[model samples]
Target chain A: MIIIISFFSFILEYLFNYLLKKTLFLPLITLTTTVIVRPFFKKNNNLFYMFCFILGFLYDLIYTGNFFLSAGIYLIIGIIINLISTNMPNNIFTSIFKIICAVIIYRTLCFLFFYINGITIFSISNLFKSIYSSLLLNIIYGTLIYLILYLLSKKFNIKRID
Target chain B: MHKKEKNKRTIIILSSIILSIIIATIFIKKNFNIPSYGIKDGMMYVNNIITRIFGNKDYYKLEKENEKLKEELEQYKDYKSLNEELNNEILKLKETLSIEELISDREYAFGTVINRNFDYWQEKLIINIGKNKEIENNMAVISNGNLIGITDDVSINSSSVILLSNHKFPLNISVKIKIDDNYIYGILNNYNETTGTYEIIGVVDNIDIPQGSKVYTSGLSSTFPSGILIGNVEDVTTDNFDLSKVINVKSETNFDDISYVTVVKKGNK
Candidate 1:
């Protein structure tokens, strides 16, 4: 039931932004509508949840030592992002902003949660730097993912299943 | 469609995807790894020789190295016995050891440096030594304070060296902190270019090692002559930073200046 969750090493900057209450003014994630549903089952209402769930699933798979943290975070983020974007049409830029915001938002929540829980030894400065670095890295990753989706759209003739 | 029907559809899809992902996690965890692609070991050197013949100045430097090695070969063969005695004493003290057993039996073979994979992804220096030269897998490869790496793949006249700078590479090294009397053991992992993170890992465990220290190979792993220069310590972040300390080792041998290299026949040449 995650709304958004993502990983990036430059999370420190984002943390700084949050502590300063500075709005990023830039999103760091890229969203991808499902290719399978967009192509065949044009009315695949559950597609958003599926994609979000899989995103978290992949995050978990990539970093196994963290246990289920990535997967849990991914699922939560997926649900949240998809729900928030429910009314918005799947325009490429809109999806991009939503994904980017999702990453920062999730990371912010994690830092606050960890800080409140007294589990982390991070100062606001370190946490902010971590967020910033993670965000920068996530932007690169998010861009590449978006490019692949663009290629998929062109090659496979897929579109938003609306 | 009815609201109830839509909610059910969403629930079913999310559950199924999440469930499948959970199941797939087992497979992905075990199998979903990045495929390693590179210029396979041996052809690289032969290619270098050809590239040199056509007036590549890089080849000339290697020609110079070959001449130097030829001279060292004669001297190395002469003092194998006295070197063996020093090898024995050191081996006795090292437990959880690698090179000690190697030196005790005096088992080693000679190999020559052929080419270095000086690319960004892999910093490995490929050598023209293999099982034929008694070079086995994981044998430490060093040339002066410059630790090249350990042997990986071996053919008749060739073996792949996993360089110290390789992301996939890990060396069990001991740190010589200027401030502390004790030596700490840590694994040196390569720098992640995208993240700009270098790990001198394992210090986050039991050892209370701090930043600004020096890291060296614990000749205990193999015959690396223990106190050879390793690297300078950087900020000591959490163990979550990586398996190693985020060490920034400014290597004595500038990567570009590495032309001549000597492969230590640790036990006996």
Candidate 2:
């Protein structure tokens, strides 16, 4: 199920960024990470971390050109997911909150990394714009992916943590 | 007591891992770029096939329209010939004055934009041609016959281009504003994302320079070839000290709509 989601996310990312050229309208890549958050607690946490490492590594390989930078960033995000969603009950409202937090965390980490490396100039306005520009699209994508996974889990009798 | 201790340990371990990764990011070589060329190109190939099958259904109609436009454009041949004669006269005068710069042959490799990286620094484009097509770093990239960006990282079959609109990098290219029978050179430095224009700084004070003057590469900088159309000046202003002029240019090339690019390399003079 995770692999399928990742594959579709990859294709959709290409569609949005390349064919449609609507990257400003939709951030399907980052929001798709939310799918694995629920499965993290139900399974072995180490395996989940490894999955994120591979996903991030692949992301860097295909897109960013950096080596393990995204891998590490994704690992950190995985930890964040575990930390935030560990105690919260699984519901639509909580899912929205988690998605919002994840987008902020992802953008902040990326901005900080780029700013520190002198790859991007630091500006409070740009940071807020970056965060806000992606928020609406990512929230919709996150909720859709979450609901799809939820339905699939129910149909397949997959064990999910409350 | 035991559960709390376990959670604390887990947090410590995760934090340690994150710290180590951050340290690695700092120490790692910035140019240690290993892009997955085959995988990306393969995906693009598939995408192209899919797009061809499902997209552009009116290809024949567009071709017919293009042919009709070419026929209609034949009436302008006299004007074109007159312009060519004037250009030849200017070249002859320049040669007689011994101020003519050596012009080199330019070779262009056409490629499709496979990816647009809209990540944090959203100014990169991945093209399908790279070292295989003799694409090198700093080679000028253009779309629709207008300057767009320069090649940055070249892999086996793909290369990344850093667009002129990139504000993160202080990549200054020498440019000249073409006025009536005169040219004023300046440095194309900054890009204003909000205004969708480029800021040309270090321009000499020219009070009579009108808006909509054509800007082109000066070829003073070795990175780009001369005479490539950059844009037209939209507005001009003086520095706070009123020493040098700052020109704002609006490029005809739509950065967002870039799908095809031609990478140009200058040959020997």
Best by lDDT: 2
**What TM value does model 1 have?**
0.38
Per-residue accuracy of model 2 over B1-269 as CA lDDT, tens digit each: 97997798578657756764665475433555644666655676656765676457558977998998798789779779998898688679878998645443367899987777555444678888888898999999999788999997787778888888787654688898999888999999888877989999998755577999999988876677788889999998888998899899999988877878999886543
Q: Please write out the lDDT profile of model 1 over residues A13-54, one tens digit for every residue.
A: 223222222223222332222211222323453565555555
Worst 10 residues of 2 chain B by lDDT: B26-35
Candidates' C-alpha lDDT: 0.49, 0.74
lDDT of 2: 0.74
Question: Model 2: which residue pairs collide?
Answer: none
DockQ of each two-chain model:
0.04, 0.37
Which candidate ranks first by DockQ, i.e. highest? 2
Candidate 1 per-residue C-alpha lDDT over B1-269 given as tens digits, one digit per residue, 9 for 90 to 100 = 69999788768756764665454455334532222112223344543454355434456878998999999888987778778887666766565355434422334345545443111213465565665677666766665555656776555556667666565564555444443777766666665443443466555545655665666666565546565556566566655645654445545554433434545444544
Q: Give the runs in model 2 whose Cα sits over 4 Å from its true position.
A: A22-24, A34-37, A40-43, B1-29, B35-43, B46-50, B53-101, B120-122, B168-170, B205-207, B240-243
lDDT of 1 at B268: 44
Model 2 Cα interface RMS deviation (Å): 3.6
For residue A47, what is the lDDT in candidate 2? Answer: 68
